[model samples]
Target: MSEPFYITTAISYPNGKPHIGHAYESIATDAIARFQRMAGRDVFFQTGTDEHGLKMAQTARDRGITPVALAEEMSGHFQTMANELNISCDRFIRTSEPAHHAASQALWKAMEANGDLYLDRYEGWYSVRDEAFYDEKELVEGENGEKLSPQGTPVTWTAEESWFFKLSEYQDRLLALYNEQPDFIRPESRRNEVMRFVEGGLADLSISRTSFDWGVKVPDSDGHVMYVWVDALTNYLTGLGYPEDTEAFRKYWPADFHIIGKDIVRFHAVYWPAFLMSAGISLPKHVFGHGFLLNRGEKMSKSLGNVADPLELAERFGVDQLRYFLLSEVTFGNDGSYSAEAIVARCNADLANSFGNLAQRTLSFIAKNLEGRLPSRAAVQPVDTELLETVRNATAIELPRLMNDLAISQAIESWIKAVFACNQYIDAQAPWTLRKTDPERMEAVLGTLFIAIRDLAIAIQPVVPTAAGKLLDILGMGADQRDLAALTAKGWYEELGNSGFTLAAPTPIFPRLEVPAED
Candidate 1:
């Protein structure tokens, strides 16, 4: 059996439509999942909407609709966005699902049984937008002298009868977990920030809210819903059929990763592990807090009138083009900015002009000159050997190493270097010129380019699935053979030649993207 690899994205809050940030996380997580699967892992990728919250309730009320009705309507938009972006999530869980409610209640009961629950009167500043409670010291003063959450979201003073979890009791344990694992939170920066916050000490967290009832009801606790974070965090388990010892629960429990935005690091790194420890459940292997996506060096916001809808961007640039640009332009684990011009230039240069052009010209040369027949083997030369080696190193070795370390941009960079090498080899060898002088040697050169293009296409499929798949199909490669192992296998080219698979007049896989006109 392949090793099980489980990953998840922070479920989007469905009070609004999906944005560029949502698309970025989904694309990044999906790429990792696809890479792992192609690398021979049994991967389960989960992404969805966080539908139960005060914000959901308030937004529904403002719109004169019930919260459930609003959740259904908005959650559809997120699902549509994921589909449009080709997110390969195994499950799209909604908190309103019966199984999820059961899972949340079960987790709450387990925590309560461990003596972590207590009744208390809670009075503090709460940020509705963030769905987080903030300590007085963490608040910042607004220009109008009003207290704001650390994220600059509005906060209100609230007094309520709430059930509290003894989060302070796990402070020492959480620190010890951090010290022992050292990688529970990724990107040294996020780990350092979390360690500092824990060292500052923890307060008992309010686990149930009595003011609103748009969430999972606390087990045996009347008139109260579980804290949105608690219900939200439980979703990771619920997707795997938790609270029941089923096959998925047994195999994929203790998630491999929880890929979330940087702003929510505390909730995952601090509160989540503590809750699992209280429930006697295993903690996830890692929580990676990726940085935000900005709009051309500025933070995107509604008031700024610059929040880009991901679907709109996808429509403007092709889906694969958008995916390739984001994965290449942004250094993972750091803030990235995108613009129309940036997307167009990046995709056109990397996809259309470089790899796409190399594949198109090489294949077209073979189809037009060789009557769409596979090139026969000719005397192997040192130049051919060297070119193949360069491509193998990039596609088979360097790219995998960087991808495994979550260095997505660097991995693509390595692949592009190989693409550049192929372009350079074609130019220097001048296969078109050789066709007349030495047809046999020309056959050898085209054969070498064919092998290199196949390897490049297989390696990059995880990032640009549609375009790469189309190119591979044109190359007569089978779906079963598009993997890392296949990239290094011997004699596949000979087998393709024997099979007499003819290349067709190819359509361009990656068309150059145009910048949309200003309205």
Candidate 2:
């Protein structure tokens, strides 16, 4: 059996419609999952709505609906966004599912049995927006005289009888874990920040709330519900069929990756591991906290009224086009700015002018000049040998290494260089002109270009699945030829054209966008 690689995105909070930020996480994680599957791993990718929280209850109450009803409505938007993006997630685990409730309670009982859970009064300033508590020292006074959490979420003073986790006792242990696993939190900056926060000492975290009844009820407790983070994080386990599914739990447990936003890194890196430690369960291998996406260089906010809907963006630009830009433009683990102009410019330059143009020009020549039949090549020339070697290095080595590092931008850049090399080869060799004077040489050049396009299409499938799949279809590639793992089989390169493909008239897959003039 192949190695199992389990990955998950932080479940979306189903308090509102899906936005660009939510889509960004899904796309990035989906790319990882897709790549792993193609790389011959048994991959399980899970993402879904986090439906249990005070914010969900309040929002539902204001709208005169039950919290579950609100979750159903808003979660549909996220589900739609996932479908529109062609996300290849294995499961979308909702926190409200009975399986999730059972798994979460099992976790609570495990921690309680470990003697790390206790009943106590939680008295402090709580941020409803963040669903977190803040110490007096962690609070910043607002200019308008309101008390705010360090993250600037307004906090309300509250004292409630709650169940507490012995988070403080694990402070040194968490620091030790960070020391042992240097890549546990990712993007050195985020990891360093987590280390610093943990080094500052920790406080016991409130795990259950009596103030809200909209969440998973605490086992053997009176009118208390498990905190949102506990219920939300448990979805990862629920997606794996935990507790009763020990066989599967053993197979897919110790998740390989947990992809989450930077805003929630502390929760995953600190509290999550601590909970797992107390429960005698293995911690996830790594948690990557990616930076936020900004709209036009400014944060997306309600007051600005500029939160872009991801579906609208996908609708305006092609779905694959947007996926390409998001992965290629944003340096993984660093903040990236998005704008209409930037999106258009990137699509035109990278997709339309460079990649799409290359494929169109090559395939069109073969379609028109060669009569829809792939040509057989003569003995490889020195130039053709060099070009093929370069492409082989890119498709088999450099791109894979960059992807393994999660250096998404770097990987895309490396692939672009190899792809653009095909364009340069066609230009220098002048295959169109060769068709008249040197028909034999023209066949060799076109043959080499064909190989380049095939491999490039295969390499880019993880990032732009729809577009790359279209490219393969135009070249008459079969399902067997497109499996990424098949690239490494013996005779894979030599036999690339052994079965031979009949060509179709190639059309441009990515078109240049015409932006509306600003008023």
The TM-score leader among the candidates is: 1
- Give me the displacement of residue 139 in model 1, in angstroms: 0.5
Which portions of model 2 miss their true places by more than 4 Å? 488-500
Model 1 lDDT on a 0 to 1 scale: 0.94
**Global lDDT of each model?**
0.94, 0.88
What is the per-residue lDDT of model 1 for residues 1-519, given as tens digits with 9 covering 90 to 100?
Answer: 999999999999999999999999999999999999999999999998899989999999999999999999999999999899999999999998999999999999999899999998999989999999999999999999999999999999989999999999999999999999998899989999999999999999988898989999987889999889999999999999989998998998889999999999999999999999999999999999999999999999999999999999899899999999999999999999999999999999999999999999999999999998888767669999999999999999999999998999999999999999999999999988999999999988999999999999999998999999999999999988998899889889989988979999888898988888882
Per-model TM against the reference = 0.99, 0.97
Who wins the lDDT comparison?
1
Error of 2 at 386 (Å): 1.4
> Candidate 2 at residue 379, lDDT?
46
